[model samples]
Target: MAEVATSASSSANSSARSVSLLVVVDPVARRLDGESVRIAKDVLSAGASHTKVCLPDDPEEFARALGRRGSRRPVVIGDDSALLRAVALLHRRRELAGCALSVVPVGSALGLARSLGLPTGAVAAARAVLDGAERRLDLLVDDSDGVVLGTVGIPPVPAPVPVRAEAGSGPQGAASVRPWLRTCQSLVRTLASSRTARTAVAPGTPGPARLRVEVDGVTLVDLDQPVEGVSVTPGAAGVAVVEVRPLSVGAQASPLTASGRTVTVSGAHFRYRADAVVSGPVGTRTWVAREGAWGLTLPAE
Candidate 1:
């Protein structure tokens, strides 16, 4: 009995130490920092029981390689965008909840990866991937099937343009249009909207916008009040921290803040920055914070 127990313990220890990895090296990371990528690959290969490195040239190939990872743990060797792409892919496939994703941050756009407690250096990140703990983290998913890893900001509002009436129509002409007609018109407008505003609008410049901000079905700010900007970020325990900077008399006022499971923003044509991407002149968007929706491999505490 004693001998059998000792043999079982040894097998358990071996099982704990052994790991199989599928390393996907982002093309952008290769072009920008090939040395770091090489180092990461070497470390991961030496540490893991088995490692298969894939060099996918395009986005489709990247998706395919990740999709066919089989039983090997997928470790992304790239920047935050690459990590996000991997996460988004897994989320879309409904596999994120079951996967423990790892990353070796290797580009200029690594803010999101670093913010999530991933080591910045290639060697450190790779080693952590080999001997790390899997942590379940919160996620903010928008109604459009978009995801935000960190902060989501509604950039400075553009100057509002007045809707004009038809030549023969009166002042209420625009309002007289059927609700469905108005929606159709806005849909067309949204489709035709130029995305240049994503880069053009700076973070804190103030242009007043009449946006209705809601948290969990409760209205925080209605269309009656003009707001300077708004931001939403996932908070602890499946809540979203929201802030609305309302335009004040003569000077900017303190932002109104709230926390909840869902946040909604609606207004005239507007664009928002989610992580590093700018999206939408959307008429309305709602985001829900999903607690512990995905797992990320990080250095063990």
Candidate 2:
């Protein structure tokens, strides 16, 4: 996928005024603070003209807070999943484009949020909510209506169930070493043509399954050909596709790559992990992109 982002020129006065803001602190974040939640609250309270803080206990309450946020900009204080939840709610209500969103990343696996250009620090991110420019960005929405903020992959082995952690548990702080390892992992993923992520299988695990794949309505691989693995990620230009071939008795394995607007995968039941969420065990799935579907608030260039 080509890098998928677009920045609108900032309005001359975007950062000049203190705007009214609805700061919804993710329930998960409230428990994980390690001081991050407090810093976020204090910073946002200080920066906005009128700040209303809502701490929703569950997804329903979270949605209600957003639906009721009249004129105040919403600032999410949680990790990527919390941001994903907010985006999905607003998208379903068809109000996403009309509402620019901000985030104060505060959980494990903050990489996706960071990769989206959000400041990883709670204070910095909260401040950006008040002073940053709004950017329109693309999203990958699957037929199931699930939203993905980052990469999607069909690893050679089954993906692990997503782990949920209490906010500041073992190396859970925003500056913890886990994210550093994740950064190195992401680099390895890139340098290894993504096989480190897409073709990972533990010993004793079953091998990859063959699946038919279609890109932009064009067939990349048909069911007749067996495949070791496949991956689909939303790139700036389009959806990036990769197909890993299993090594033959005498031939080396080769991976195929391509990009398109939509990608379809069908075979026996398969699963994929998209951002922080996982979906499937279904026979087929399709993911399509809506260019510039929503806005993300980020630092002005």
Tell me, what's the RMSD of every candidate? 15.7, 9.5
Give the Å error, residue 132, model 2. Answer: 1.3
Name the best candidate (by lDDT). 1
Which regions of candidate 1 fall more than 4 Å away from where they truly are?
1-16, 156-206
**Cα-based lDDT for every prediction:** 0.81, 0.73
lDDT for position 296 in model 2: 95
Give the clashing residue pairs of candidate 2, or none. Answer: 1-235, 1-240, 2-235, 2-236, 2-237, 3-236, 4-236, 32-167
The alpha-carbon lDDT assigned to residue 85 of candidate 2 equals 88
- Model 1, 1-301: lDDT tens per residue? 0000011134344543477788888887876677898899878876766677888888888999899889989999998889989999999999999999999999777778879999999889988998899999998999988888888888733433334334334432333555676688788756645444353344333477789999999999999999878999999999999999898898659999999999999977667888877787778999999999999999999
| Cα lDDT tens digits for candidate 2, 176-292 | 446666677668645765453454332212455678888888888777777666777667754554454642445765677778888888887776768766566678989887777
Stretches off by above 4 angstroms in model 2 are 1-16, 156-206, 237-251
